[model samples]
Every structure is written in C-alpha cells, then in structure tokens.
Target: MSASPLKILLCALEPSADALGADLMAALRKRCPEAAFIGCGGALMAAQGLESLFPVDRFSVIGPVAALQALPAALKAADRLADLAEKEKPQTAILIDSWSFSKIAAMRLRKRAPEMRLIKYVAPQVWASRPRRAQKTAELFDGVLCLFGFETGYFEQAGANTRWVGHPGFQAILAHDSDKAAFRARHNIGAGPLLAVLPGSRAAELKRHAAPFRGAIEKLLTDFPDLRVVVSAAPGAENAVRALAAGWPGGAFVVEGEERFEACRAADAALAASGTATAELALLGTPMVVAYKVELLTELWARAVLTTPHVSLVNIAAGREVAPELLQRDCRPERLAAALAPLMRDGPARRSQIEAFPAIARLLAGERSPGDAAAAAVLDWLGTGKTP
Candidate 1:
C-alpha cells in the first residue's frame, strides 16, 4: 500500500495563532483523517491535539525594541523548530504569524527540507510596511494564506501562491451575538454609554498605552460622569491596566479574554489602542478612537519602515480614516478626549460612524473563514503535488 499519509506540521509562534492553528488542524483532520499533524502551538493548539514542542507565549514579542531584547531566545527557539522540521521531514509545514521570527524560521526550514512544502498561514503586513518582504515571503514559502482580501493582490504581485482566507475574527464575531444585558450585569456596569478601553494585548503595548489610556478614562469620566469605563483586559495585563487606572472617580472594570468582545459589543463608544483590537471593535459595531504609543527609538525606526498612513486595520482596510488615529506623541489624554468625544456624543459624527458599520461588515464578510479556506488550499496543494 502507499506510504502512510504525509505528516503535516503546524507551527504556531504566538498565542493568537493558537486559535487559528486549532481551527486549521480540526479542518485538516476532517479533510484528510489519515494525515498527521505535528503541533507547535500554545495552550489552545495543544487542546486541539497538536504535539507541543514549546510554549508559544515565550515567543510572543512585538516592536523593534522588545524584539531586540528577545532576539537570543527567539533565535534559539527558531533554530530548534528548524531542526525539528528537518529531522521529521514532514510533507508540508505550516508556519503561522510571528512574522518577524516566522520568516526566518521559514527560510531555515526551506534550507533543511528543500523538498518539503512550506505554507505561511498569515502573510506579513508587507503592504503596510515592508512591501519588499512579499518577495522574501514568496521565496521562502511554497504557498501563503492571507487573512484580508486586499492582501491577495499584494502577494500575487510578488509571485507568491496566495489566497485570502478571510479573517477568522470576522467569522467569530458574526457567529456570536453579544449578550448586552447579561454582560453588563456580570461586569457590574451601570448601563449609560459605556466606553470600552482596549490598551492592547502585548506587554510592550501595555507599557506604552496603559498610562495614557487611564488618563483618557479619567477624562471621559470627568466629562461624562455616567460614562462607564470598561477595559478589554488583554491576557496577563488585567492588573496592569487596573493599576494604571487607580484613583479614577467611577473606577474601571476589566473584561478578560473573549469576554472583551462582549464588552465591546455592549459599549456605546471606545478608545482603543491601535492594533487587531481596532478591527474587533469595528466588527462589534462600536465606534472608537484608535491610538498607539511606542518607545521613542522604536517610533523613530517605525517611521522609516511604515508605509501606511493609518495603523488601525479598520482605517487601513477602509482606505480612509474611518476612526480617528492618534499615534505616538499625539496620543495624549486631551487629544484622545477630543478625538473620542465626537464619536461618543450625539450628532452627525456618531450617525456617520454607525452608518459605515454595514459596509465594513460586508467588506470583512467577502472572504471565507480562515480555517476553512486555508484547509481547502492545503488539500488542493496536496492533490496537485505542488506542496512537498
């Protein structure tokens, strides 16, 4: 009989990738039950039955400064992953996000198993910053799965085998309805125009934003005494955001993990630190002001690399400033107040924002769920012998 079905390696380098990786693995098993999946994932991926070689949390780092500090450990882990891919000789290897390190890991894997197919789950935001990375990605991986519709064109232009697999976040939000009353009751929030504050998920992100976000919280509470401040507490940063908001009049509350989505859905407006949360807020139909803060040196370096005018994915995808963005030094408490006041207060601005939600949702709905589309593309590659 034919040799046992090819072993597929699913490598995840960050926590968020954990969920995406699990979904993909489940789809793969359903599509080809005989195929084996070697797991490189966080807790979520492990729960999906992926054999974990290392914890993904250790590898999660963003921004140039933070990455530099973690470079040694990151390199060691990447090397270990590369060696595993080489020894295993898997038919195909799937590398999820953590673009900075994943790209290097992909290159190393390609060198180790020239015949093995390398699939990149989430293409880097090359269109936003390093457009040249697209060429590098095409050279390193056999195929790429993009989460956004606009990414397909950018990747294809670089001669990469790419597909827009849709953002799983979109599918997730669309599938789940917000339990507004239950959510408010559970959080002990008095319902009167809640303003959700999402500082960001990364530690470095929290350091830069938590303080200013607290200031914004104080300002909102001062101006609108009834405004309930609900913070979407990123995993591991609950206490940090809370500590920063010490001394606030009304006091702030934290919504951890997935509960943050529910809080976002229930909120009338939000002041979000620019990142993935911005997109999440949009999907929840919450009007928001996007802000970002980073180290002075990192910001200076980023200015050289960042090509996009807007950092928030909502604004980037919309091709216009759908939500106001206050970045770096501009992310002051007063300025943040000015930016968010209009979105939260009654008038034409709020109506305009509310009106744009449908179009945004429609744009996000264009692509298939990330897991289904990625699994289908991988299965096709398997059939065509284009991968491995």
Candidate 2:
C-alpha cells in the first residue's frame, strides 16, 4: 500500500512571507507530490494550494505600537491556528516571518501538538538586535531555515538545527530580465532621468512614508524638470501608493505586480524604503537612497536596541554603507533629495554603489535555488526526524 499523504501546515503573515511560502510550497510539492498544505497565508500561498486559516492582513503590522494595537486579534488568530493544528494534526508546521506572530503561534502549537515538528522559515534579526531571541527561537522550534549564511551561526550556537537556504528574492531578481524601454513605453515615460519610488509593502509603511517621499520627489522636480517618477506599489498597498503619488508635484506613475521590476531596472536611481526592496534594487544594480520611518516610541526603542550602524540589508551584508540610509528623523525631504541627487547623476557616488552590488550579490547567491534548498531541508527533517 502507498504511504499516506504528508500533511504540512504553513503560516505566512505578510506579502513577502506569503511569496516565500508560495515558493517553498511549490518546491515541496515537486519533492513530495502527495504532500498536503494547510494553515494561513495571503494570495500567493493560496495559489500554491494552501488553505489559509485566516486573512494574513489582520496580523501584518510593524513595530511595538502597531503590534500592541493588533495584539488582541493576533492572539485570537494564533489560538485559532493552534485549534486547527489540533484538528488537522499535521506532521510539520512551518512558520514564515512576522516573528512575533510566529512566536505566539509556535508556543500555542507546542502546547497543543507537542509531537509535531515546528520549523521557522526566516530567522529573526538576532545579529542586528535582540541577540537573546536566538536562544528563545532555538527553544521554540525543531529547526530553522536561514535566509542568510551569517544567520546560521547564531541559531546553531543557541542549539537549533539550522540550514542556510539563501534568499529566494535574490534568485528571482537575478533571473528576471527587466525591459527598461518596455516599462517606459508602457507608461509613456520619455528618455529623461527616471526615478523609482518604493515606499514599502504594508499599509502602515505607506502611511508613514508617503509625505516624506512626496516631499523628496517635489524637491527633486525643481532641480530636474524632466524627472519622471515611477512608484512601485506592493501587493496590498497599490491603492494607497497611487493615492499618495497622485499629490506629487510632477505626478508619478504607479506600477504594480511584475512591472515593478521593470521600473526598478529602468530607473536611474531609486528612493526606496529600507527592507527586502533595497536588496532587490541592489541586485538589479540600481543605485538607491534608502529611507524609513516608524512610530516615535518604536524609533526610541529601536535606537536603544539596534546594534548595527546600517539598517539596509545590502549595507549590513557589505559591512559598510553600500546605499545611503536616511532613517527616522533623518528621513526628511531635503536629505532624501540630496542623497538621491548624486545617485541620479553619472558620478562616483552612482558608480561606487553600482560597483559594490556585484559583491553583495555574490554574498547572497547559493549553490542551488533557495526554494529547492528549503524544500530539501524540510523534507530531510520529515524523513529522518532530523535537520540536514
């Protein structure tokens, strides 16, 4: 008789996580054709055959203030996930990013289904702040699949089984052939100095970044009248991004879905929010000025806890500021405009950043695709009851 189908649970609480989960699910399906997926994620994971337990948007928040605001709902959702786990009794539960929510859900899963293997897809930023989380994460999950090679040591030192699967975002960005002319033609953009503006993926991020980003763009338009702006809107933030861009001085064209990459490749410089988007821009060889802002209380807390000098992943990986980061109070219109001005022109500032990108790309590249590596790691654990 054939073996029963392997049932796995996956929880991805944000669009980025949803994409990661989707890639993982597809790769897992290739390896274990009979595998069944349950739990929660967004549309991407849903397309990959996951029957999500709840809408991921409810828990998609950033920083302490937003987290506190969403806590009650998040708690209920975590419990619901635990309840689902009890009923489904999947052999494995893979929790993607959104660290706090995953931690809560993992704890509940531990209580309800102690026998089931729990895995964390993305390790917390222990190297940057909250180093103690490595030990806590080690205690919670059976294994961790790290996105960066540097992440493995922390988790391994804390006594967790860890695999460095690299970052699939890099793989996707590297593989894509972005057509600059096509993107410009599609939007009727001319051969002027073009700028790609990526605020962020979340609604909260858009709300925080909109004014400053707009201010910067308006300031830039005065210096470069022919400056064409393209706003790359993330999955759930398209409407907000459009609304935000509409009020800009010279007007901005908003691109969603796959076209964002084209805009990234087409632009001379990018004014981007510091996150996964920065990494994507780096991989595309786009010189950029990275900026971010959060609640005042969160900023204060972050200032106290953050050990790293640079917040951009490209900067962190390079061990230097590959891209200029204007964060919190420094994320003002004039500063952002000044920082981007150098990048938009053909000068040493632009050349230096672009030159540094290949090395950063090499640092992130793995022997195989991240999806295949992650899927193999998960399957290896299931087969041997150990992390490979």
By lDDT, the best candidate is 2
lDDT of 1 by residue, 295-315 (tens): 888888889998888788888
**Cand. 2 TM to true fold:** 0.77
**Where is the poorest 10-residue window by lDDT in model 2?**
361-370
Give each model a TM-score: 0.82, 0.77
For model 2, residues 1-388, the per-residue Cα lDDT tens digits are 1155799999998988998899999999998898899999999999988877878787787678999999999899989989999998898899998889889999999999988899999999898889999999999999999888767888999999999898876777788987888878878887889999999988778889988999998899889998988899987788888887886765588899988888899999999999989888888899999999999898898889998898888898888998999998899999999999998899999999999988887666555788899999998888895543
Superpose all Cα atoms of candidate 1 onto the true structure and report the RMSD in Å to 1 decimal.
3.8
lDDT of model 1 at position 20: 86
